[model samples]
Target chain A: MKEDPFAIKVENVSKKFSRNLRRSLFLGTLDLAKSFVNLPPDTTKLRKSEFWSLRNVSFEVKKGEIFGIIGENGSGKSTLLRLIAGIFPPDDGRIVVNGNVGSLIAVGAGFHPHMTGRENIFLNGTILGMSRSEIKAKFDDIVKFADIGDFLDAPVSTYSSGMKVRLGFSIAIHRVPEVLLVDEVLAVGDISFKRKCMERMEDIRKKTSIIFISHDMRQVERICNRVMVIDKGKELYTGETLNAIDFYYKHTIAKEVQNIDPKLIVYESTGDIYNITLNITNEKGENTEIFKHKEKIVFEFNFESRSEYQNPILGLDIVSPEGITITSLKNVIFGHQRPSIKVGHNNFRVILEDNSLMPGTYRIAFKWRKQDNFSLVSATGGRFAIQSEPELVPFGGYFKVKYKWIQN
Target chain B: MEYKTIYTPNQRFKVNIFKTWYIMFRNVYDYRELIFQLFKRDFLMTYKKSFLGIAWILITPLVGIVNWAFLNYTGVLDPGETTIPYPAYVLLSTSIWGLFMGFYVASSNTLNAGAGFIMQVKFPHEALLFKENFQHLVNFTISFVIIITTLMLFGVKFSFLSIFFPLTILPLFFLGSSIGLIVGVINIVAVDIGRVINKLMELLLYVTPVLFASNTENENLQIALKYNPLTYLLGVARDLLIEKNVQNLDIYLIISLVTFLIFLLALRLFYVSEDRVIEKMI
Candidate 1:
């Protein structure tokens, strides 16, 4: 593939932040005291103590390419954008841009509360490096796009969050920068406005390169031509959008499960000389099928016990990647009994049908305990990837609904 | 390919003061429309909420004249000995003083007002400050017009030399802006300087010959007051308005030259520390 010429070059860029928030005043005083005492400063150790938010992270953004940066929280995606925007100088390495850059890091960031929308538009335009005449030429288009006709003359403090975001987006898009940096600004505003902004971004991408940072995986997939996944200030993967999201889930979610201590999985209860094996099956009743949206999943637990107890309660739950409990099941509600294993094996199965779930990955967990004491007996879990089948699902997510449009 | 030859493999970041100033001026020029818009917004919005509207501009100086009259009546000020009526003297001093104080206050706080823009946008950091200070200049010009009309109402003689007031203010404006730029940049890294500047301005009010005339007989005080550029500026304004004589042309020229040099020096310091200081502070 031919490189479209590097519009922005980030070479070995690393940004170090002072980890010690308490050191601000103390460092100032220390510097003062050092000069007074005539002592050699320990600047070397202080520099080393700083935390690197982005460490030797390098990437090239081609002209007219929409580059998406996907990551979990605190993964330095916003920091990278700030660095490229020249908000701060990199402690080590360099970032070079070939043309003018505009950033929409946060909606309404530069808007003054006392200034009216009309005033803020010019102020923000100037701040974004737009000439007065340039802003004047585009002023009407900006107001029209924001859709806040009469309110433009009113103070920005009076504008709603959606209104603020719309005006901000309108001004940023009007700037016509050679490189545009956007950071999760689309998460605000209504759905229609979001679509409008997406379309505007698409239009701008024809002439300018963009670096978009967002936590919304689907949105990234929809807009970005290539996506990069960052984890713990390291680049995990950078390539196709789908592959990056998959790598992110695998490393951030699955790897977390992989790191769980085996000893932590043990639970205390009645001493039973037996073992339990958990198997997950999809709606098709196939052993290989993991999970699907609105599809039933069966948890088959095969276990053996040395002796029978009075009652044993069994529970199962499906947890999302972020540890959100999507759904759970308990045998106690059904008044089920476990037959004596006689030092052998026994099988128990629970089926969850038509599970209303969002199209994302999930984990299945199993738990068993004595009925009276409610003490844990054993617990285990395995990974399950819940997906939406393109053929049947209208939209992939937790909730399913239908809507009709009428042409008037 | 042509691309291979056009795209250099290695390019270094160099810090050039002249280049930085060029960028700063280019950005300010480009954003001139926004500056004018903000100026108009500030000018109109200020008078919008007032009960008297634009008359407040004349009304403020009239109040000051009335206060001076009371002071003179009580012998706090000697009217018979002064070259001009107490009201005219007070009006001239206050008009020029107001311009200086307004520019000083606005320029010093320029960075604070545009902090968000500086952090988010890729423009000359000083443009925001300059635009804000320029707004104060417009306000001062408006108020000066009101003062001149009031002076005429008082039956004071006016001459062509009075036109020099605007030229006289240009040097003072640059001087105040230079000081403001330095203080504004310092305040970005350390907020303590902002508070200190307010307190320092208050202290300067008493020491400077704005409210009270400095006695020429006191050799020590005269020399000290001469050292203050603001004193010379106020003296020039008073001479032009009241005495109708130009005093110390060389001093005014020296002040102008010194101010221009300082402004250039401040601009250089700002460019050099632009990335290192503000980036760390913000």
Candidate 2:
């Protein structure tokens, strides 16, 4: 039989956290009293305000794999990471990380403010499981990577929050721990530093197995060979990144999401426009709120015109989740400037081929205006999630562009 | 020691005293570097914010000794006659007693001092106790210098036996750590225990014969002093240094032995309850 190539293996792990202070006080004492005689807490069941933060969650990360954990706030993702890091012991079951485990759980958690940055490099590095010699070996590299030139000898209290994070991250990444547990601390670094960290992580990924817990779906999809989606301390899905993300969006957001207004979303200034309805569908004519890269999406709208006008501009705006408008489509830039239409209940369709919107939830803001006067009427409604193949989505741009490199 | 440690429930608490000591010793040895680094941080930190810096360590006791000497000189209180000068006697005794108090403070503050590291990092938390104790030792040595100065100025002579000070006061160190460990645990879960213990240690200080001679004329105070563990733990260490006769060796040995056992149990309790401490800290 082939040997299992797993770096961290968690089996039937569970942890309980008391919900309130009074309960924590009472139960903390009770547990301490129980432990005084070398006995364990009664983990088989819950008593009082205690609830399992993680319950019977099991998974394995193979050697040299970048595993991702995705979940909503208050889910057991952090608890599981803590358990595997041995920061918290499991209430039941086992966790076996074959080699030493390290974490970026909270960057610079061990830095003392009165101490100089050089001093903290030694202290925090040791606390993070680096020996003095290893720290000395990487001291110059750590300072260079942190890029806080003049402040290297100043007390860490003088460093800005970002500088501290950079220093902490710099100290953390120098060594290759067999299993590294990373939280969302990566989101703190600036663009260039973030890119450097990703590159460094890629370099380390050849030898290290990483457990990355992040809300940044793009990074998760880009780096993770496999992803696990969890909710309320239970596993929802655990396999391939794209499908896990799909399952996550379909479950978490789909449940409590408010339905879009079905009535005609029209403004008073939208002259000649009567009742209207917008529809987004896949090429097969089935309703879809999702589209993949290069997929075909048909935008259909039906409206009644009280009066006819020449060359009305049809507009559709796709806005990213961050509220920045990605693009706006105007009929003047594309198809016919004028189309023959009946005055009542006229339907029009626009097919958007080769959709290149990056992977994120985008809202559509629709507008219509007279081409002659240039005055506009606008209404925003409906949102859809677009997923792209992880490789094609380039950095530093919201919308992916269609381009080809020519080497002559 | 295994490189990999498995944590599980300690169900049906059985006191594994030997195993507990082994793990505690092994972990302390392994984390000596962290302990030293932490000690350095605290040693430099405690005096930084204060205007007087570490002079306050000497100032508090100096002021306390002066107040007591004035009371004794005015006949407001009879502390009985002492072999050495009155000020010197009180200074050395309280300083010796202060060692116990210092250890108690240091050990009690261990869990709170490392609260930040405890919540986020995974390491042996008990290693903090060593750092706390080490930092206190440096502070105590500073105070000890002042004690030597006070004794010299008062023309007090130390016996040849003063060299055994560390060994003589071993019980006080153990007693302080034991009491502090439990009190520290209590302070975490129930902070009010700290206030109660503070008042209680005040009462304990009066009965421990630190400020007065053990042979005070008052019968009630004498009886309280006789039963108090410090009557031997703190008294002998001071008595031996001041060239006084060792009193009640049997009781002293018994108290020292009892202190050793309590130290063992406290070590077990502290090592065992650390997980809960981590839980409460977070």
What are the clashing pairs of model 2? A37-B13, A37-B14, A39-B10, A39-B11, A39-B13, A40-B9, A40-B10, A40-B11
lDDT of 1 by residue, B1-282 (tens): 212211111111243556756767786776676566556655666776668877776677667666755765576555454466655666677778778777777877666656655677655566666778887876677767766776677676765577676777877777777777767666654557557976786676565676567554567767778788878777786676666567777797898888878777666655544444444455
DockQ in order:
0.19, 0.42
Residues A123-144 of candidate 1: C-alpha lDDT, one tens digit per residue = 7776677777788999999999
What's the C-alpha lDDT at position A56 in model 1? Answer: 73
- Residue B7, model 1: Cα distance from true site in angstroms: 16
> Evaluated on chain B only, what are the TM-scores of all the candidate structures, in order?
0.82, 0.87
Give Cα-based local distance difference scores for all models.
0.69, 0.78
- Per-residue lDDT tens digits for candidate 2, residues A1-408, read 455578888888888888989878877777766666566777778888888888888899999999999998899898888888887677888888877888888888778887889999998888887888889999999999999999999999999998999999998888678888999989997889888888888999988899999988778877899999988888888998877876776665443223433344545554666667778888999998767767888888787877666677777787766668878876765565566445777888878786876655666777776667564456777666665443643342566786898999
Candidate 2's C-alpha runs over 4 A off are A1-4, A37-39, A255-317, A329-359, A364-408, B1-3, B11-16, B49-80, B217-223
Candidates in order, interface RMSD in Å:
7.7, 2.8
